[model samples]
Target: MAALIDAIDVKRKTTFELEGVPYYCLDADISSPTARGGQTLVRLRMRNMLTRAVFDKTFKASDKFKEPDLQTIPATYLYSDGDGSYFLDQESFETLQLGEAMVDDALELMVEGLAIQIDLFNGNPIGLTLPAQVELAVRSTEPGVKGDTASGGVTKAAVMETGLEIRVPFFIKEGERLKVTTETREFAGRA
Candidate 1:
């Protein structure tokens, strides 16, 4: 049996030789935060070896990862007509369509030909991560009433370029750029 030791036994930034292979100790922890749709969810925080960027992401523990080498591909949004989503791989120039289940609420924020980064596992697309903030055109909304600012920050419904209606501060008008929270579809502020 291989020797087992507490994860803390390794010193930070210290390299160790194991089985003729050199390895650096990295701090990481996995936790099942919650269960959704009958899947065990896990959150992980890791640093990118190349960029040194710290990233935290959640995933289903049941999903098998072949290796730590996860690939990020630039894909252009082809189209999504409420049924499914399609994209074009910029490097391979191949077209791939993902089911609605895979795309999830991301379909609500997509604009045709929009470039997004997709994470792939074993050549299969797993999840999509979008920009923190995206400027979208407001398609429709009620005209702001004069003196409406007196209210205690009440919001009104506004439709976006994607036809998804969300509540925004009364000052927002049609055709204006508004920043939205991609997760909750809430209005962050006027762009």
Candidate 2:
């Protein structure tokens, strides 16, 4: 049997199970009553682990949720094909496949041999948790001419090896490795 957590305890990045499906909390807000003896509401922005859907719902502060059987393990990017993207679990040496919907925009940040974390629910792969930053090589971009850096905050479009296009600084050139922040999908710095 799993332990239960009260709604008031739920916060950002919390994982709990409702019914039989696992849910990840993106954000949580608690609203207290202005008058006496009023019920408190815990509004949460949650994402469905299996379906990758995001929605908002409100629950009473006293509501209880069962902690989910979720685990994250290190994995290495293997390849992608007609079926979906593949990864090799570093801990167990097992091969895992995540569907297109599950991979989604994350594919743009992945490259062969990249290290990442895979989220598992009830011993089955549910979704992927990307690293905060990743190193990607620029596949193509306009040439950076001399003195371009004189204009501060200038940027140009660049395509990464994994097909992600991002606005890089004007001094960035083709074939240079860059640090990219996964959450915002923006250029971080030189790698």
Per-prediction CA RMSD (Å): 11.4, 1.6
Runs of candidate 1 with Cα error greater than 4 angstroms are 1-69
lDDT of 2 by residue, 60-167 (tens): 999999999999999999999999999999998989999998888899999999999998999988889899999999999998778878878889999999999999
Model 2 pairs whose backbones collide: none
User: Per-residue lDDT of 68-174 in model 1, one digit per residue for the tens?
Assistant: 33468998889976667889989999987777766777877888877888766447775566777666889999988888888768788999998888998888878
TM-score of each: 0.61, 0.92
Give the Å error, residue 34, model 1.
26
* TM-score, candidate number 1: 0.61
All candidates' lDDT scores? Answer: 0.66, 0.94
